[model samples]
Target: MVVEKNAPLQPCNTFGIAARAQTLVRVRSVDDLLAVLADPELAPAPKFVLGGGSNIILTGDVKPVVLKMEIKGLRLVEETPKAWIVEAGAGEVWHDAVAWTLAHGYPGLENLALIPGTVGASPVQNIGAYGVELQDRFESLDAIDLATGQSFSLDAAQCGFGYRDSVFKHAPSEAQDGSGLPRGMGLAGRAVITHVRFRLPKPWKPVLGYLDLERRRAEAGVEHPSAEQIFDWICDIRRAKLPDPAVVGNAGSFFKNPTVSPDQCADIIAREPKIVHYPMPDGSIKLAAGWLIDACGWKGKSIGKAGVYEKQALVLVNRGRGAESVTGGEVMTLAKAIQTSVYERFGIRLEPEPVVV
Candidate 1:
C-alpha cells in the first residue's frame, strides 16, 4: 500500500484549481483498497474516493484521505443474441472507452462522445449528452463499501438514477432501510466503484433526436450514418461550444438544466418570451440553463479569476493559469451570483452540476 502526504492536485482536476490532498493513496486495484482498509492507522480515517476529477471543485486543500482510483481494464464480459455485455474498469477514461467499444464494433456509447471523467464517475452523476445517458446502457456495477469492506453489485434500478443524480450522490442514512440494494438509500462517500459493465443492444440505432445532432445529420446529407460518424460529429460540436480544460480550465456544464411545471414554464415564457424549454416525457418542462445564464448576461464575464465561457454561459471557467488560477471560492461566488440573478429574474433556482468539496 503506497501512500503520499501533501500530494499536489492541480493536475488531477479538470478545473485546474490549485489544491492538495492531506494524504493520498493510489488505488490501482481492489487489493490496494483492501490493504488501506486493513491498515489500522488508515482504516479509521475518513476518506474521499476520487476518479478522473472532471466533475469536482476543490475549495482548498482536501482534508479527507484521497483514494485516487487508477484501476484499469476493458473487455467483452459476455455477448448474447440481443445485446453485448462489455465491462470496463472504474478508472478507465470514459471517452477512450466509448471509442474502444465503437472500434470493437459495439456502438451504443457513441452519442456520449467527448464527455469528460472516468467510468466510475459516469454512474455517480448519471452523465448524459445528446440524446443518450449512461443509465440507458448501464448493465451493472461492482463497488466496495468503504465502511464495511463489503463487495456488492447493483443494477440500474438499485442505482436510483435521475437527471444528473444517483444513489452515489446522496447522503447515507443509517435508518433509511434495512435490506439489500434498496432504492433511496444513499451511498455517497460510503462506496467505491471498481468496475462497470454496459449492455449495448445488438441492433444499433442512431439517436439523432437532439436538435444539434439532427441538424448535423441533415447538413451532412447522409441518410443513414454510422456510429463512428455520430461520435465524430458530437466531438466536433462539443469542441465548437466548449473550452478544453487543458487550454481554458472548466468543469463542463457547471449547471444542470432546471425542470419546472408547465404553469411555471408558461409564466417564465410570458415574461422572457424567448426562454428555451422542452416538454419532458413526464409533462414537466426542462429549461436550457445556458439560455438563462446568457439572458442574465454572464457570458464572457469575469469575477476575480473565474469567468463564464464566452460560447456557453452554463460553464464557469478558470481564467488564470497555474498559480494564478481561479480558486473554488471565486468559482462558487460567480455561480452564486449567477444563481441569484437567474432566480431573481426567472423565479427558478438553478442547481450546480459539479460536486463541491
Candidate 2:
C-alpha cells in the first residue's frame, strides 16, 4: 500500500475534478487495507471506495482517505450441466470480468459489456444497462467492516438492492463526532466491500428486453441471436451513442431515467402525444431522461468549462479545465437546471446516477 498526502485527484475521477485527498491509499490486498485503516495518522473521515474512476463527480477536494481498490482475481468455481458459478475479486474491472465469462462460454454476463468500474462497485449501484442488472446474477459479496476490520459475507437479499441503490449507500444513521454520519460509516457497519461472487448461466439465452436492442438486432438481420451476438450488438450501440471516457471525460449517463406512475405518464403523453416512454410490466412508466433534457434545449449547451456533450445530453463532459477551472461546479449547476426544468415540465425529477461529492 502506498499512502500519500495532499494527493491530486484530478486524474483519479472520470469528471476530472481538480480536487485533493488529504490522504490517498492504493490498496493492493486486504491486509494493506487493514494497515491503512489502523494508522492513526490518517484522519477518521468518511471513506470513499473508488474503483475504475467511472460514475463519480468530484465537487472539490475530497477530505477522506481515497482508497484505490486494486484487488484482482478471477475463477470458475462450479459447473453443472446447466450453469456455472464464477467468482471474481472485487477489484477486477467489471467489463473484463464480463468478457472473461463470455470467453469461457458462460452466458449470463454478456449483456453487460464495456461498463466502466470494478466488480465490487457494480453491486453498490446495482449497475444495469440494456435490460440487465448486477443483482440479477449476484450470489454473494465479501466486505470488511471499516471499524472492526472484520470481514463477512452478504447474500443478494441482504444487499437491499432497489433500482440502483443498496444498503452500502443508504445504511442506517449512527452517531458521529459532529457531522451527521450513518451507522455503516461507524464501527458496527462502516463496511468496505473487498470481494464479490456471481453465479452465471451456462448456455445463456440472450435477453432482448430493451426496444433499442431488439430493433437494432433485427435491422442487422440477426434473429434468434445467441448471447455473443446480443453482446456484440449492445457494444456497437453503446460505442455509437456514448463517448469513450478515455477520449473524453465523462461518467456514463449523468442521470437515471425517471420512473413515473401510469396516470402521470398519460398526462405527459396527452400534452406532447409524441413523448417516448417505456412501460414497466408492474404498471409503472419510465420516461427517458435524455429525451426530457434535450426537449429543454440543454444538449450541446456549455456553461464555462463544463457542458452537456453535444453527442449525448444525459452525459456531462469536462472540457479538460484544470484544477483552477470551474468546470466541476458548472456541470453540477447544469445538471440541477436540467433536473428542475424536467420536473416542472413533466412533474418528474431526474435523479443523478453518478455519485456526487
Candidate 3:
C-alpha cells in the first residue's frame, strides 16, 4: 500500500477547488484495501472513498484518510436469453464503460454516454441522463465494509436508490423509510464499492422520453434509432449545453430537478406558465431546475469565484483557477443565494446534488 501525504486535491475534483488530502491511498484491488485494513497504523482511521471526483466539493483540506479507488476491469459476466449481465470495476471510467458495452453490442447504456465519473460512483449517485437512470439497469454490486473488512453485495432494492441518491450517499442512521431497504442503516463513509454489474435487456429498447432526446431524435429524423445513434446524440447534446470539466471546472448539474405534487405544479403553472416541467409516472411533476434559476435571472452570474454556467443555469462553475480558484465556501454561498431566490419566488426549496467534503 503506497500512502501519500498532503496530496494535492485540485486535480482530483471536477470543480477545481484547490485543497489537499492529509493522507491518501490508491486502492487498485480488494487485496490492496485489505492490506490497509490489516495495517495497525491505518486500520482505525476514518476513510473517504474517492472515484473520479466528478461530484464533490472540497470545503477545506480533507482530514480523513482518502482511499482513492482505482480498481479496474470490464467484462460480460453472464448471458441469458432475456438480458446481458455486464460487470465493471468500481474505478473504471464511466463513459468508457458505456462505450465498451456498445462496442461489444450491448446497447442499454447508450443514453448515458459522456456522463462523467467512475462506475462505482454511478450507483452512489444513481447517475442518469437523457431518459435513463442507473437503477433502471442495475444488477448488483460488490463492496467491502470498512468497519469490519468484510465483503458484501447488494441488489438494486438494497441500494435504496432515489433521484441522485443511494444508501452510500446517506449518513449512518437507523431510520427506516419503509422502502424495503435497511435505510436506517445508511452506509455513508462506511463501505467501498468495488465493482458494479449492469443488466442490459436483450430486446433492447431506447429510452427517449426526455425532451432533449425527443427533440434530437426529431431533428435528425431518426424514426428507429439504434443505441449508438442515441449515444452520439446525447454526447453532442451534452457537449453543447455542458462545459467540459477538463476545460471548464464544473460539477455538471448543480441541483436535482425538484419534484412537486399535482397541486403544487398547478399553482406554479398558474404563476409561471413558461416554466419547463415534466410529468412523472408517479403522478408528480419534475420541474427543470435550470429554468427556475434562469427565471430568477441568475444565468451567467457570479458570486466570488463561483458562477452559474452561462449556457446552463443548472451548472455551477469555478471562475478562478489556481490560488484564485473558487473556494468551496464561495460555491456553497452562491448555491444558498440561488436557493433563497428560487424559494422566495417559487416557494420551492432547491436541493444541491454534489457531496460536500
- Candidates in order have lDDT scores of 0.93, 0.80, 0.92
lDDT of 3 by residue, 1-357 (tens): 688999999999999999999999999999999998998988999899999999999999999899999999999999999999999999999999999999999889998899999999999999998778999999999998787787889999989998999899878775544432234538888789999999999899888877788898899898999999999989999999999998889999999999999999999999999999989989999999999999999999999999999999999999998888999999999999999999999999999999988
Judging by TM-score, tell me the better candidate of 1 and 3. Answer: 1
C-alpha displacement of 122 in model 2, angstroms?
A: 0.2
> What are the TM-scores, per candidate, against the unseen true structure?
0.97, 0.92, 0.96
lDDT of 1: 0.93
Q: Which is superior by TM-score, 2 or 3?
A: 3
For model 3, the superposed segments whose C-alpha errors exceed 4 Å read: 174-185
- lDDT (tens digit, per residue) of candidate 2 on 1-357: 798889887777777677888888887798888887788775366777788778888877777778888899988888888678888887898988988888887878877888888898888888988888888888898888776566778888878787888888765565554432343422223777888888886567777868778898779887788878887888888888888876777888999888889898888989968777898768899888888998889899877777788877888887765644545677788788888888888778899998777
TM-score of 1: 0.97
Alpha-carbon runs more than 4 Å astray in model 1:
176-184
Preferred candidate (lDDT higher): 2 or 3: 3
lDDT by residue (tens digit), candidate 1, 1-357: 679999999999999999999999999999999999998988999999889899999999999999999999999999899899999999999999999999999899999999999998999999999879899999999999887787889999999999999999898876634443333669998889999999999898888888888899999999899999999999999999999988999999999999999999998888889899999989999999999999999999999999999999999999999889999999999999999999898888999999999
> Candidate 3, 324: how far from true, in Å?
2.0
